[model samples]
Target chain A: MAVEPVKIKRGFQETESLKMLKESAVNVNLCYQCRKCSSGCPVADLTARDSVSDRTSAGPLDEKTGAGPDSVPEALRSGMARDSVPNSVPEALRSGMDLTPIQIIRAVRLGLEDLALNSKTIWLCTGCETCATRCPQDIDIAKVNSILRIMAYKRGIKPKLPNVAAFDRQFMANMKFFGRVYEMGLVNQLKLATRNFMQDMDLAGPMIFKGKIGFFPNFSGFLTMKKFLSRFKKARAGKN
Target chain B: MPEAIAYYPGCSLHSTAKEYDESLRAVFTKLGVELKEPEGWICCGASSAHSVDELLAAALPAQNLQLIEDMGAKEVAIPCAACFLRFKTSVYDMKQSKHLEGKVAETIGKKYGDTVTIRHPVEILEKMFANGAKNQIKKDLGKIKLACYYGCMLTRPPKVTQFDDCEDPQTMDRLLKQLGAETLVWSYKTDCCGASLALSEPDVVVKLSRDILADARACGAEAIVTACQLCQANLDTRQGQIAKKFNENFNLPILYFSQLVGLALGLEPGKLGFDKHLVDPKPLLRKYGLLL
Candidate 1:
């Protein structure tokens, strides 16, 4: 089944965010069309068509010296032996050079150019605001990249992987219906939605292993979460 | 007489992150702020819809926002950054356009009135704990330096989750102060752990997570504290694998904001879901006298 492409209009429909971004002085006109921000971007453009690099040293920055090579830190090698790389990462990008400003930015730019390829790298940005902080003219490379990632996404760039989009939806639906995230129901719905009838397959192993996934999104009553949701329905019905 | 707010908890809180849900409410109870969850609320569709369809993505959060205002709530209170950022994006869009509001409202059956407030739990927590609450903590987390990992949603897209300072948020710090934990001044508090990719792209999860862990340990933190469940899962469950695969030794623990709060509030470690984690936080809990 083909998914209808996303459509963006001149305005936002609505969102549940209360902590919206604070407005700041705009300096895009100051851009001078400078690609300095792009030049300095740590997540450089890499072609999506290229395979992932299999190198394992792309760790994040060090807290003290502030140095991490975007290498695969010690945390990524689970589930298999030391020699295996993850299925999602492109071997070229993985085995390629580290995410130096020019490298990461350039690679990402190329990868982003098509905006058809998906990788966790989009969301993988530390948002250290380093790129934003590092740009010669303060181009907000971080924000731009984030938007680009979203844009690439809006243009259909995905992670080439599964996500909690549906899980996020169901969780909110639980809150929208019950006034809180229903843990059990949420896991069940998510696994079920992803697995369809095979939902039981995903849950069976996890359930037997640790009851990790719940059948219902459980919401242990806190702060009248239940009451607030019920009242909201009544109050909402009265208005409609 | 209190102001009303809408609330949204992305999937993690419902299942893996339930402790965060429980603890956030505990903090709320102590703060005395009121939250009005919207009726017939729906999902924010985080990175999912945002990736597939902008409007479809925005509509979910829009509908939830509309319900909040329609039900008489001032705005929405989002706990998850994914939910917070996604919803806030729509709120920003609402701030910019009127037609979009009508379109989303038509689909979801709610109105995105011109005025609405979309806030994260940390924002409200900071607000409620503002008036001398920071200085009035009865408990002290003591010496246990924590790497405050904000990850992606809570910070970036500066246009969305406009909580505290985007690059360096002080809200989580304020709340941490109330909890009596010593938060390390790390640079990546607002970094992305590649959360939504945990299961789909396990490799990215491993890489991003190692960065978080490496940074935390580098900062001399005994563990990591995050507001998102995916972060918690990645740090806790995925860390072990990353360590073994990459031949890096890591014993660092991961703690939910609520678990940290539960510790400060003197709640038992067990109740905070300590046992559910693969890495042991027992020593950290012992330091706080919550483990024994």
Candidate 2:
């Protein structure tokens, strides 16, 4: 039993997500589905396969009429069947979000705000800039993804990948408290929050022995940083 | 033209990547360059900050730059690639957006004129090698093949970093070649090491780093030299896990470029802090007669 892929209406009001992407200087309209971004993406192999299988398993579509495979438009079914290897498409295109970099751009173009914001793609992005570096239209997909992450956070959307969000929150909190990232403190906080305490415990003893884990947080410029960060809060409030 | 530049040893250097900081200081000192640490510098608001709050990321590094500018230093050297990128991004963003610049200045309590230049230690070392520091190479690192891993930050989004060719950077390679080590030409030179995700998604980091290590080994590299703190830590610390997961040998020593430079300049191994690395590089160093 497979569900039909949600069909977005052809024209809709410009989405807030789309406006944010445009304001962030990402040229979402420039993407022509060249798939250059997916081809060079390092995480594409791992993420794309999962997304693609999910899409295909949800009822095969007739190529011509865009319906089910049983009542196929005949000509297009053969073509799709020929390319049904699933892994043949670029990894980014096969993503479970139904939105690789190009598809995300397209979704934004089509005003699919919730769909774009809720996708696992935003969390998985490493901000490596490989996609941006290779984008033929010179789209800064990496920056676009960053802005998306910020938007996702502001909207209070729980990330599909919880650990990454946990790490991001823990990291920022560490900086907010100590004025710098105290690794030992950060790890403890992260372990507690995520409760995966023993995940990297094997490397801990060796790291501690090597004197890499400082016992106390280095509070250099604590006062100045605290004062400075207040202004940031004010500015962010003004923006919101 | 200033003889000494301010040095910002970001949190990693103070903790996990101490060897990178120590070796950078030693190599610079040997080259007659002095590194000055600003009295009160904060974090650069690494990968985490930018994703959550844009202002915090820019303002955090802007504060450090303000401190450096206050000290009257025309330049600052950052050993960590992440810190270098943050500093560079802050300067670039401030220059582009006057509104953002004003907001950051208000936050930091100082208006940075974008005067202080942010430099990676690799850039400084490249400059030193160009300025006759090649003559100071005390020991010829004989027949030791090395893979100079630039990782992602030092050179990417070309306009921001402006360090080298974003795709196929050879700055570290050229520096190692001058140090008398055979730098291998490999495709994974600028690949992402799944930084920060080492904790959140260790599987991704392991898979990505495994490919990098396998490529280095296939390219005949005995050890991988890196300029970024995260790259060094991720590649070195995760090797045992990567090997166990993949059921393959990936015991390549991931050394900082500064450590190799320190070795070439005849600095003490103790001073270089090679003992701190999880994958002890001493065995590889001893094999190359770089250690006694």
Candidate 3:
């Protein structure tokens, strides 16, 4: 049975912070309901789709894909058989272009307020940039993903990953303060932050036997790092 | 400037991934980079414990983090994607609870100092490229086209493994650009390669592996280059099954970033450990004249 498509609601798009990010995004209206991007996508399951729920559904190359720098193989090289894949593959996909134009447009219209500060999708992107590299419009999909993330930070969507969000915040804070991520202090602080105190109960006998963990930050390395952090803090404060 | 780094080489490097370790040594030397290992290093509990028990995962790497503190290396660099994620998460978890350090001290007998940083090998390479090492790669595979695969850890859960841009990471692309290879724009870089899942649910692994290989071939990658050993193993070793299941031949070769680095460095195939791969890289090497 063909699965029915449903639209997922994103709550933060209209907010003030995302306004700037959306303005810079590319035109998403160019979508023609093509499923090549979906066909080419490796994590469609993560995004929950056979058909993209997003408004745009265009592939990267409908035209230039023939002779462009990013085009698929010429007549001869096309002879290389990838027998493992099925025969009915979509032409838009095999053309070698990512078709996430709507994302660029959406970012331009939304200003990334939602992406930066509210959406978990910002962190979910792995920078495969296949979307951009293969975009029919030659749009810079990867760069947009980056700028969206930077915007997320700008809008105070500071670190929300379940396992690593706390660490990133602390790492950034520690870096912001010390001008570097203090290895010892960071670990010690992190252990305290996570409160997984009991897991080490088993390791206590062995740790004491080995004397692996310790107290206090080492406070070594080049002293100039401290000065750098101070300046960085002041610079960021100026933005605030 | 590169921070003083505490380096972790998971068991694979000491054994199976010796090429990665050895190539890293030469690459680092060429790039003027130094990586230090903690004195009382322990296993990252591999990639399994992290998923099964987050706390245990944090504790294992925490124990090592504590050791890194003892060794006093400020920055941490991990090449293995699984280890990289494990360390990143452990420190991330430890940093959240505040009291866990003391708790860990009670259990592990040593206090973990916040003295080290964590990074992946690609980050180191990206840093070098951003700092102007692009001009150093004299040999250009200008004629070769590649599909660069990062698998899962590089781009997922962005807050912690902040090595590069996740949706379209440029680290490998930038490096490949320096080597004069055309990297395809594909969506599978951060997709799962089914790592240990191959043994547990190989059906899932095969499906995922097939998708990744198909994506690579679909984009016309003359070869697939990877940063993770498991990704290499899955994409290179499992093709026969992928072919059997999907009824197609995916004889594509998967190469390590180090092998490519060796190739660009004008090093011999023997020096690159090309022979060690279960699937021969010779067919692709022959095209590039790196093999007889």
Instruction: Report the number of backbone clashes for model 2.
Output: 3
Error of 2 at A168 (Å): 1.0
DockQ (model 1, Cα)? 0.12
Q: What TM value does the first chain of each candidate achieve?
A: 0.35, 0.74, 0.43
What tens-digit string does per-residue lDDT give for candidate 2 at A121-182?
Answer: 77778888888889889888877777888888999998877898999999988888888788
Q: Can you write out model 1's per-residue Cα lDDT over B44-90, one digit (the tens) per residue?
A: 66545544344455566665665566677665677877777777777
Cα lDDT of model 3 by residue, A204-226, tens digit: 34323332233333233224334
- lDDT per residue (tens digit) for residues B82-197 in model 3: 77877876666566565444444444455566677777777777677767777777567766888989876766546556767766777888787777788889866677665653
Candidate 3 wrongly placed segments (more than 4 Å): A1-240, B1-5, B32-35
Which is better, 2 or 3, measured by TM-score? Answer: 2
Which candidate number would show the highest DockQ if scored against the true structure? 2
Q: Which TM-score value belongs to model 3?
A: 0.56
Q: Give the TM-score of candidate 1.
A: 0.66
Interface RMSD of 1: 7.9
Tens digit of lDDT per residue, candidate 2, span B184-245? Answer: 88878998898888888777787678778867887789999999989998999988887676
- Once model 3 is optimally superposed onto the true structure by TM-score, how far is the C-alpha of residue A41 displaced, in angstroms? 12
Look at candidate 2 and give me any clashing residue pairs: A51-A95, A51-A96, A62-A67
